[model samples]
Target: MKMQKTNKWILIYGVIAALLIALHYVLQLSVFEVWNEYVPFLEKLSMSLFLIALIFMVSKIIRKLINTRAHLEGDRYNLLRITRLLAIVSSLIVATSFLFQNLYAAVVSFGLISLIIGFALQAPITSFIAWIYLIFRRPYLVGDRIQINGLRGDVVEINYLDTTMLECSGDYLVNDRRSGRIIRFPNSLILKEEVINYSGPDFPFIWNETPIQVAYTSDLEFVEECLLAATNRDFREHYRHFAAHEWEEWEPAVYFRINTYAWMEAVISYPVEPRDTTGRRNRILRYALALLNEAPDKVQFPEGTLR
Candidate 1:
């Protein structure tokens, strides 16, 4: 549908250009006639339209190429952005060059104009610069879950001045589920605020802990064993091969802690994929609870009241 629209406009421009050329010959309109200065203006206008149509056609082709060749979403998006930027810049340069007969004068004038615009649009310029920094620094890329300042979400788009995120945890929700709200913040904020990225080379797994409270009289060994059993059942297959090669020394472990209410706290520490944190924790807790129920005499959970 979009391609059809583009082709339609291109055809219109081609027809107009052909008509303009035919007009010059058919009407015998001289470029320097007494009252026919409109002749040259019409020619220039026609040429501009033709150039714009050509640019759009080229841009569309390049976009298709990028979409086909660039495997990663982020890479495809960035490449398309660059392509559009180049098209706009090139069109501006061509139009300006046509407008000004003297090339050097045009260059000098553009430089001064850009300097003035730079100072006038300080905030926007800063954001654009920050965008460049983001491209190189890669604090967070598209699809990466991140928390900047207090906002937490997956980056959906990174525009020239604004970064759009699909928010995860909003006011009502505490878990890491999507809130269906979107947030757009200035790119310049990256320079001012700390960015916490939950995705990286140690991807598909992040350190997570689940604390299980048991009565002080419970067998500590039994509690530890139950915690380990639940965790191993859920995560061992996922992490076993990668864990040994990527992180040679790290393994799932259970640590014991003393609670203020005299209850024994069993902290099950393990690695979990960011998206699976809540679900995995829920499963582990259910498994632990079911197993503890089987041996109630050995492992008892803390009651609501301290004593």
Candidate 2:
């Protein structure tokens, strides 16, 4: 199978070489004598085609070499190494072109190429710049949960122009969780749109609120104490490291108050690890309920009469 694939590629390469040679001859007959001056535009044209083919061949060879090394040893950083190789190859190509071509010819070729590519890829260039910024700034890493332009998800991959995500909310999934659907978003949006990185440098913990309603006669003070006790006992350890790393302090508190309708409202505000915010909140709720279950009768709803 591999041999057949190799044969097919060889045939394709031969056909491409033949076509480039024909195009070169046709270009040789151009009315513009400048096209035939200096380097013979035909040779230049064929060289350009040959250079493109060489780049692809080199890329394939590098990939194969990486795979072979990975098989021999257990090197798992092949993708990063391959990307570096590509960058180096691109730089070498640019340097060689500038070195060999006459200054005037080089300038004309570069100017025309830049103008055409710039016009064709303005947005893509912007996105690529944004990707570079994200990579260097370390705003968010792969697997981090983030929200951008109102779309929330766990980042799956970061490509040249866009970052891919596994969508994590709305009708897409049960309990408003990650739906397993992949969404690709332009990196330029990171610069243009507001990005909320749940696990960023300073924001590694999510402020989670779990509100509970109780009867008017319920003791607000007792409820507050119980809630605080439950939170400190169950979640303090789980979120302590996150708080220390992100907030540089720890102060977990729960507040209780009586609303206008005389209902006791206990709002528990606690620190939760950014990655597991939802799960931690649910666990806190379970623990709070278990604590309240000790006084089930006292946890009754506020009294009211229907009109």
Candidate 3:
């Protein structure tokens, strides 16, 4: 559906450009030569239209070719953004051409104007430079969950001046799910602040721990076995995507921690994707509690308010 609409719009723009160019010549045929005053305007308009249409058509082709491949979504998004920047630049050059009679004059004039504007708009220009840095440095990419400064979210778009994210665990929510809020921060922030990208290529999973309070008299071995079994079941059932990666590196582990409430904390550390942290922890807890309840002497839960 989207491709069809794009093709239709491209055809429409092409027809408009063809008519504008032909009209530019048709009026100079001596019969309608009285309209020669409009010739220059028509010529510039036609050239701009043709160039924009051509650029968009080529960009569409390139994006379509790349969109078919899997696991290269970030690369495809970067290329799309680059092509759009190219279109803007090429259009500006075309518009500048007719404003001056010669190439040297246009270049010099635009260079001087850009120098003045660059000084006046230092913040925006710095942000644009930061955007360029993001393209190369890639601290985070589209679909990656990242936290910068105090803001935590999933990256959705990286524009020339700002980076947009879908915020997670906002003021009202306690879990890691998105809070239906949009966050737009200046790209320049990347240069000034540290970014925590949950997407790790080397580990392929975010190491997360969920703590459960149990009486110190509880069977330590049984508690560990139950927690590991619960986490392992969840991993085997829902997170099999990590199977091709390092298997031993992501194995679930249980650690005991002393609590001030006179109870022991069983912390189960496991590997999980960022988005699935909450749900995976919930499932593991449910399974672990069910298994532990079958053997009451093995595990004991806190009955008072310290839960």
Candidate 4:
């Protein structure tokens, strides 16, 4: 239904455009003979408007097609940005040609004006260039959680000169929870700083580890089993269905090593979604502690520093 409406509007635009062109030529040859100087300018302006309308209409259709298909969200967004840039460039070219009668004069005038503006807006121009790089390279996209130069957040918007992020782990919080703060940073920073994108090709999960310090006298096998049980209990569903694949076999792995405090450090490494890391770790610890307490002889937690 929406596509039909779009097609109808496109047809209407085509008819009106054809009529406008026909009327423009008719007026130039007959009705506007006395105003010859202004007639050509008027005709060119009308043609330029029609061309811009066509460009935008075609761009809209292409954007619609991309959005409806199975393309990735990042690809769709980058394509939209590229389409908009192309439309703006095309419109400017058409308008410049229509407004300037001499091609040489237009080039000279544009060069001089651009030189002046470029010098004046150097920083902003660099940021805009960075924005273009972002559109093409896709270091990150909206909804992706990222950390750059100590600011960690979910990207909310990417403007022409700046990117806005909804800050996470700010001020009072240590977890990956949003802090109700918005961070607006210049896009040019992408050129200078390393951007860590938490959600990417290995998206929906990242490796996280929980370290448990236990007495050396405890049964190492029983401690490792308890840790494994805790993680499996928390993330069994994720491991069984969404995470496991032929290319990547996702599951919890346990390792043990001796520590300086005369305690055995048992680490349970597993895959966890970025947002759920802190919560998942907390739950695993709670369950593991309960299980360890039930079997005091088998698993004993470290009490103090090394003597």
- Candidate closest to the true structure, highest TM-score: 3
Selected candidate, larger TM-score, 3 vs 4: 3
Which 10 consecutive residues of model 1 have the lowest summed lDDT? 23-32
Instruction: Estimate, for each residue in 76-186, the C-alpha lDDT of model 4 and write its tens digit.
Output: 677777777888877777667667765567777778888999999999999999998998788998878999999999988887899999999999897888999999999
Candidate 2, residues 1-307: lDDT per residue as tens digits? Answer: 6445645665576667668767666666656456556447456657667655555545545554555555412122325444555756564564456455654665677678779999899999899888778767766667678888888888877777889888887565545377778889998998888887886655546777788888767766777877788777665557555434444454567777766666767899877766676786777778877878788666665666610
lDDT of each: 0.78, 0.68, 0.83, 0.81
lDDT of 4: 0.81
C-alpha TM-score for every candidate: 0.80, 0.63, 0.88, 0.82
Put down candidate 3 lDDT per residue, 94-135, tens digits, no spaces: 667667755578788889999999999999999999999988
lDDT of 1 by residue, 71-174 (tens): 87776777788788888877876577668744576688788889999989999999999988887777877877889989998889989898999988789798
What is the Å distance of residue 80 in model 4 from its true position?
0.6
Which candidate has the highest lDDT of all? 3
Candidate 3 residue spans exceeding 4 A from truth: 20-49, 69-71, 244-246, 302-307
- Residue 11 lDDT (model 2): 59
TM-score preference between candidates 2 and 3, better one: 3
- For all candidates, the clash counts are 0, 0, 0, 0
